[model samples]
Target: MSEATANDFASLDAGQLAALRRRAILSCAIGNFFELFDFTIYGYFAVAITRAFYPSGSMYGTYAAFGAAFLMRPVGAIVLGAYGDRMGRRAALVITIGLMAGATGAVGLIPTYRAIGYWAPILLVLCRLLQGFSTGGEWGGAAAFLVEYAPPGKRGLTGSWQQFSTQIGAVTGSVSAALLASSLSEAAFYAWGWRIPFLCGFLLGPIGYYLRNKVAETPAFERAVETRTVEHAPLRVAMREYGTRMIQAFGLSIIGCIANFIFVVYLVSYAINTMHLPSSAAFSCAVASGLVVVVLTPFVGALTDRVGRRPLILACALLNLVFDYPLFLLAIRGNTFKSLLIALICNAVFQALYTGTIPSILAEMFPTRVRYTALSVSYGFAVVLFGGFAPLISTWLVDVTGNPFAPAFYVMTGGALSAIAIISMKEYRDAPLE
Candidate 1:
């Protein structure tokens, strides 16, 4: 979004800057790839996790535990976001990846309720809390790192690597789940097979640590330090200086949060449990949707550079608002993988518009003085409120209201609010970052 399209390489040669950009993007995107990989597995296989950690008939409590991870996110955002702002983005990124990898791996190794009774579920919750805390800082840090390292005027496309990598992670989780579900017997899947995905998450720590450490610091963060502009108390500075913008960021993020949770987290389980579809069907739908988002995100992100962020997001929100009910109805009516795939692709297109542009939009909002803290805390708040609770709330709504597609109403509400927020907020797609 920075209007300064000219290179500011800090006396580096063109080749050096280009190499730095590639490494920076790769490092950040891989961290994001792992974060979403583990998180998506947890959501896609929530039913199995619940069974492993809780008493047999505790669907509601399982979802509650799943959502509980979100509550810790804001706390992590405050602490780690400040760490990024005060210390450095690289430091925050390294710590987040390490914490996330450890917690995720630990979840797979924990004893089941059958083995350890109540302590099993409690331990599961603690691991999720740690994962959630690390994740709180991951996105904002990645976005800031990439957007800063990006070639001037090319932030939209570079920033979108974050969402692009996220979709890669989503696809990995879904495909892995589908393969295991279709191959292994249900008894095996619920027993030991499920632990494979979580244990694989442990690889994230070393890979991410090595990649992040290999790259140089971003141009923006380095400049901040050189100019002595980095704040000592970024949280307080952000709250006091950019409070209104933070609320606007929350509103803008709400619909994307719900849409993501609905498609990536809740929809698969809804198909498997509520519709009695095959587990493979749910996994297929997730992979299809993630692939679509992955393909569409970078193009739309690049489009935002030409057309501005407002129009793209407005189109996304309006399309989502108009089609939310119909998309669900179509998927419900068919109750087949093909039907769900079509519906998900449709939803992913509109969803991509927001996600594609959002990294640039978020990074453009607050000045570099508190960019990481501002974006992290606002995104953390939005996810905790709408994204995390979506699974439990959607299930509860269906149970109480007897409407299987009750979640669509929540999506529509978010769409309307998102449209309002976009119209009210200033367009910063062309503004300078600092």
Candidate 2:
């Protein structure tokens, strides 16, 4: 393949290239799907995990442990992101899936605090950190893979698959949690039932590794290597040369990441614990919102190719700023299953518009040589700073201010920041990748 050269890719007929793109998409999508599934199941099962790991039974300890994972993300972004830029995207993706899945499986097997004392929470936090580290690399690597493989006019559609897989993973995780929570007795669920999803996620790791290994290296990365343009030190180059671009990606990521965690991941918990809604109903509603993202994101992604990335993403950011507070009020005051579902779905629609285009935007911001490291670092820091601790911070906001609508303020802050980024960004929808 080293001798094959960029001309080899150029020589491929349309049918051959199309087939190759599909394989690339499937291979890249699988790892992200599994990664998100495993990560999300932990969030969905936080209540059970809190009961098992925290002796005091206060969710603060569990939330801290959850937030601890985010702290490792930027480190992973710098480390694994550089690895991907240097070694290869495929190599880094394979390693991330193994580490992520292995840690997830370990979480399933950990003994509760009653059985293991303080060691239980220690073990749980360790596993979460490992998951976070792997996830930091997985998303950027996968996005780079897909967008690099994408044909000129179809980058948005191809890149959307990254977020599409993510939504599917969340859907599956929500469904798994909903099923287990609904079917098991409360005592049983708190005991062994919650481990089932984690273990199942573990079982799929090897399969993802195998599929990724079978796929070819992306044409863009291969060309960079062939041209001797691959950066030996991508992280340094990115920091020195692309600081402004990195900031743009970071700012753009803020609202989407926060909204995803707050509305999609945390809302279930908020519904159950704060609003006192039924667990089954909350998870089911999450599934509905996730489905909306899964179904709508691709179409919205395709739309961006026609309408321009700036318009849709800017609209999403502005709308999120305008509507999140009222929606939170609707859910908080009404406090019904239907009301919560409606609010979540509305958030999901806005979320889809941004997420669908972000993969392409991030990928387009930098050249193939330093793309992985730069994109990963920017996105990872944004998530760690704004999104990763969303649940904990939102909880604290409510606790301190005595307002259940407090989380909306957090989401609105992201929207405002991201709107500035979107407004400042150059429209890259029709631009070629560097």
Which candidate gets the maximum lDDT versus the true structure? Answer: 2
The candidate scoring highest on TM-score is: 2
The residue-by-residue lDDT of candidate 2 on 225-330, one tens digit each, is 8888889899999989999999999998899989888887677788888789988899999999999999998998899889888888888888889999999999
RMSD for all candidates, in order, please: 2.9, 1.1
Regions more than 4 Å wrong, model 1: 1-9
Q: Can you list the residue pairs that collide in candidate 2?
A: none
Query: Which lDDT value does model 2 have at 389?
Result: 93
Inter-residue clash pairs, candidate 1: none
TM-score of each: 0.96, 0.98
Residue-level lDDT tens digits of model 1 in 1-434: 12131235556688977987898898889888988787768887887887788777667777887888898889889999999998788889999989888998998899999998999989988998888898898889888888888787788899999999988988898888988899999999999888999999887667987788777777788778877798999989999999999999988888898888886678778788867889977888888888888999999989988888889988888888899899999888888888788888899888899879989888899898899999999999998998888989988988899998899998888889888988889999878889
Candidate 1 lDDT (Cα, whole model)? Answer: 0.86
Show where candidate 2 strays beyond 4 Å.
none
RMSD of model 1, in Å?
2.9
- Shift of residue 292 alpha carbon in model 2, Å: 0.3
Give the per-residue Cα lDDT of candidate 1 at 150.
76
